[model samples]
Target chain A: MSSFLPDILALFFLFSLIIRRLGVNLAFQPATYQLLTYVLLLTIGLKGGQALTSEFTFSLISNSLIVIALGVVLTLVAMLIIHTFSAMNQSDRVTLAAHYGSVSVGTFAVALSYLQLKGVSYEAALNLYVALLELPSILVGLWWLNRNQSSTSLKTIFGHQSLMLLLIGLVIGGLYGDIAEPMVKQLQPLFAVMLALYLIHMGAVAGSKFGEFGSNQLFLICFAIFMPLLAAAIGLGTALLLGLSIGGTTLLMTLAASASYIAVPAVFEQAQPNANVAQALVASLAVTFSFNVIWGIPLYHHIAGVVA
Target chain B: MTLVFSFLTLLMLLAVTLVAQSTGMVVTNYFMLIAALVVYVGWKSRKSVKVSLLKRGRSAA
Candidate 1:
């Protein structure tokens, strides 16, 4: 039971939610969340880059291309569903689909922690898959939303703070891996604690959305819940075709299952000013993120184990 | 109306299928717990739902 410490700490989000409901005004500043996000993402990038320094193969390139394709397909399908079923305008639909289609770092961290807790071994290069999977969805969504104008430039998209941080870490770690090893090792022990704090912050944010849910949003709610499951199936099939290990399959599934609450929201707001970002947040952070943290990770692991 | 119902039904079916396919007791239990949470949310959202239904029924009457 002691070994389950990290897994247990994952529920701090629920604790944060309960305390907020009781009128505990802990007014955490925005910078706190921002700093936490930056540290964790950079850590992941460094680790993946370090591994690639030694283990880099042509296969990494191929795997990344496939993952990018997955992100694009997921975004397109989500846009189609929203367009078909909902009354959201073009910008809102594109914004919402981009949120669903991109990957969630928080969810990825939880899944990675789960794999480690279970003593499962996965490819170290899989960390690169996180950054790799983040871009294509947002790019595709931007293009789809602004197909008329030439405003969707590579500069604006790649300039996103989160993406830049990850890429910078990847480059530094890949080029100077020997020098970065000491820093990575120092940061390793603090990972779980940082994640717990981050989840608590996330929980409070998600909790605030609970009261905002209305019956009119039922289709969106259903889509939020169902998208992860559907994407997990796709992730699983891809993992198997690539001959990934069980741990790798589970992480891949989590990547596909997650929706972007951190990176894409700000970018989407900037890219499509007319879109209602709050609506997307309610679905992604409130419904899908909660589902993934509590249930989706374990279910994906179970399915992967059964298949492998 | 039928479209929303169709989607809800499809979601239920998919959730059931995934849970049914799980071989672990713990995983199955998680599914059960999520189902209960879904029901609670549904109950909470019933006010608007009931109001909409009541309006429809009165118009028909």
Candidate 2:
């Protein structure tokens, strides 16, 4: 898990860049991308379910709650940091904040694979923790951004496609468990193939956009790179103080460190279209996503080894 | 059949880790060197590409 993460991440980062560069018009190829995303989600759900069945103790649930709380708090702190640094307006700040607050599914998937490889077992409830942590911080960030204005509706805020899929995936996975074994068997191979293809496409997209890393993008990219480490440090310290295991500490740190590209971006597009999608997308997809995959996991593992 | 896939995935993951572990410092150095190479290539290519695009636009104008 530890060793393969860097390579897997690097591959994904390159894949995303290549896909972007292909200029194949993602909008027209919605089904392909959508299936790719679903497969990823389904993989996450199944793995999470399996993990949950293994480690569903009272303490695990309690710790998951703690992790969720910490995730939200850390997200707010990251938002505050972004606001302080960038001269972004309130709406843009809120949009960015919501983004940094929510976890990236891609990053989480990589982290999960990393952990599994390293032989580190975490609580299955953490899947729910991952799902639960996505929406609230978004709400909080949006509410904070719009508190001055009275026109925004909650329905409008929560009505995001990625968010809907996440919630539905979680519910279906949790309720069905492995009882959906027939379904799992039917879907697993298809999902696996789709995941690999999506990843390949992602690599192509990211590789093509590698040229877009200009001076302005540099600052945003640097923020994504370093912020995860800083957040992980804070999370690790907090997790230790709260008395979590080594695995728990690592997962918590990961959750804190990850930035959402999926749910947050979709929401921002609808809610705050004025926010720089190009900037956010470049930062999240090109900078942060790549860094987390290649370097961040190893750094976290090294840190966890030192501390734990 | 499902188990076979799972086993294969696990094996692939294991292979990845084993290679990284064996190479360790060499792998890290390789990554850093490759990253530098990619950046340079990307920058050089981008400059020419941007220049060409600008020239084309000016000609049209």
Which candidate's TM-score is highest? 1
Instruction: Go through the candidates in order and give each one's DockQ.
Output: 0.29, 0.03
- Model 1 Cα lDDT, one tens digit per residue, A1-308: 54222246556876777677776644358998888888888888888788889888798888888888889988988888787777778888888899988999889988888888889988876788888888888898888877888776566677777778888888889999879999999888888888888888888888778777554367666778778888888899889877899999999999998999877888877778788777887889988988888767877887888886
**lDDT for model 2:** 0.63
- Chain A TM-score for candidate 1 is 0.93
Model 1 chain A, poorest ten-residue lDDT window?
A: A1-10
- Residue A9 accuracy (lDDT) in model 1: 50
What is candidate 2's lDDT per residue for A1-308, written digit by digit as tens? 44333455456555455556776422226687787787777666765665566556677667666766766786687677666566566665566566667787767766766775678876566566677767766778767766777756677767766556666666666667777667767766575455456656655655555577554443465456556666777778866866666666677677777888777777767666677655666666666667667766666665565577
TM-score on alpha carbons, each prediction: 0.89, 0.72
Model 2: residues >4 Å from true position, as ranges?
A: A1-5, A15-28, A47-64, A185-193, A208-215, A241-245, B1-61
Most accurate candidate by DockQ? 1
